[model samples]
Target: MISGRICIGLCFIALAMQVSSAMAEVFTYPALRSSQASDPEQSLLTSTQPMAVIYGSADIGAFVPVIEAFQQDNPFIGVEYHQLQTLEMYDITQSQRANGEPAADLIISSSMDLQMKLANDGYATSYQSSETDALPHWARWRNEAFAVTQEPAVIAYNREFFRENELEPPRTREDFIRLLVNHDELLSEKVTTYDIERSGVGFLFLARDERFFPGIWDFVRILGQAKVKLYSNTSPMLEKIASGQVVLGYNLLGSYAETFTQRNPNLGVILPDDFIVVYSRIAIIPRGARNPDLGGRFLDFMLSIKGQSVLQNEGNFNPVRADVPPSTFSSLIFDRYGERVRSFPVGPGLLVYLDQAKRQRFLRRWQDALLNRR
Candidate 1:
């Protein structure tokens, strides 16, 4: 039988095949699309077709309701969204542009580092408007890439398990290390976290932790000794927790966790008090976009009060705009995180961990503890 970690990889491959097939077909048309990709199922053909922007968001489905609201006003303008994996979208944009092929009009991704790298490497267009101006300094870099959402990487747990054990939820990395150290036997195989080796966001979060926290390596060692399960994405990792296979999860997206609480009251989220990593979904108009003007209009509409509100209410997007009232969820995050919320800025700083030498060194260390333990 395959090892458990290898099984996780195979399972992730299957999951990706299911969710990313449509996106891959749209992006790689020559191989997959028939001559008659006329139907939306085949070609994403919708009525009022005009402008299209290929985006890279795992939760691209959420954009539908928000975009529909935008269409209500500009009925003539239709923004077709083509979603792809974050890294694939970035690499494809670069290759497509280099080969003189059409690329995305706008790129939005949760992998803020890849987006920032594209902008830093001169793949993004510089456009400033009231919309861009409204964003905080850290959220926008060089009038190019802009942060579109305010979300956190949080600790999610099976509420039922904690209640039954009468165990206090961890509120910091140190606290989590102690939890693992103390209950190593109970959590031996009942803990789950992102597999940084396979996941772009996971790599980013862990690398950022290494930068800010000196004790991150110790915590990783603790998790390794405890035999923590690793998953590539939030959806599947969280499913295991909901099903009681896993009792705790680390570095899960807070917004996604909030969505879980509605049906599974046993699923709970907590922002670390000592420090929490805040991630923003960054958006940028590609320098080679065919619909540059349309992209700008969409950005404006996204930042506009109405658009922002629609995103918050309809799409469940965590608002990045200061104007939007904090949802109960956001309020809780703010209340707990307080000044400990470290919003990693959207700029060259993100590119540091992407360096070839540095990444290899980081992974070497990661493997020394995590891979060896497994």
Candidate 2:
């Protein structure tokens, strides 16, 4: 008779094979129109120019290459980007729609719930990309929003500082507390992370932590004890780590970590082995877009290999395609120092409940535990 371990191994192998097969069956690349002429040169020549206006967050560095490549390919199309803060983007997009001005051609943001909000409010236009089959279900919304990049919030540390302090990165919530307690002097003020009270993305990160991990509040309390520096934005946290102003920080997005490491090779990223939350930055075209056709073309470009590669190289994001080869920095995904990265789905309903009141309540509690009480 086969042993239980043998049976489990077989089950995992079968599961992996199924997943691989499904990934293989997903959308074809370049996402050209099937109705168009079969001749590749003809299709390229006949492709419509993209005339789109994108409203996105200032934090989305991954989109730079996508925009550039799209413009280069469709020279006649004018693609303009309006960068705003998370809340500001939401307000402006809403106000623009309310004023009956032409809606933005595209919306891309790290604020997953807000993106879902736009989809639910009937503000987003739905056009399924041919590449949708390759993406995980959680990454695509009712064909309204498509996740263009997979980014995980992780711990980033300055390698030189870690070595100087004889510090090893935290592998678990408990380990994190232990390090804080023992290395108080070494860590001192050289640790930082997001202030959930002040940031929409930060609050979402906290909510996810609470949802996925039991005793997350207790974990927060440990961070309180550490007296870690907190920043309102993720960029500053990354900057601190890179400058060695802080040795380590939590809530650093994978994209930011990747970008920072390219410039500062001594920076290291660790995705915990037990539980790491992976968030996808998503894209959508608004309903009544000024240039709906251009928006569609831009969306196709984003899912293309060339566009995804820019995100991988410049913004430090994981390409959505399974066939894309992993880069040198990609090893961080499979590293042993942390928990397996788990994808977090931002359901449509999540946005309905994430109002300002609820957000404030959560942040108040978080601050009480991490800042006020500490």
The alpha-carbon root-mean-square deviation between model 1 and the true structure, to one decimal in Å, is 8.0
Say which candidate scores most in TM-score. Answer: 1
Write the residue-wise lDDT of candidate 2 on 280-311 in tens digits: 77788887788887777887887777777777
Q: Number of the top candidate by lDDT?
A: 1
Question: In order, what lDDT does every prediction score?
Answer: 0.75, 0.69
Candidate 2 RMSD computed on C-alpha atoms after optimal superposition onto the true structure? 14.0
**Candidate 2 accuracy as lDDT:** 0.69
The TM-scores, one per candidate, come to 0.84, 0.79
TM-score of 2: 0.79
**TM-score of candidate 1 versus the correct structure, residues matched by position:** 0.84
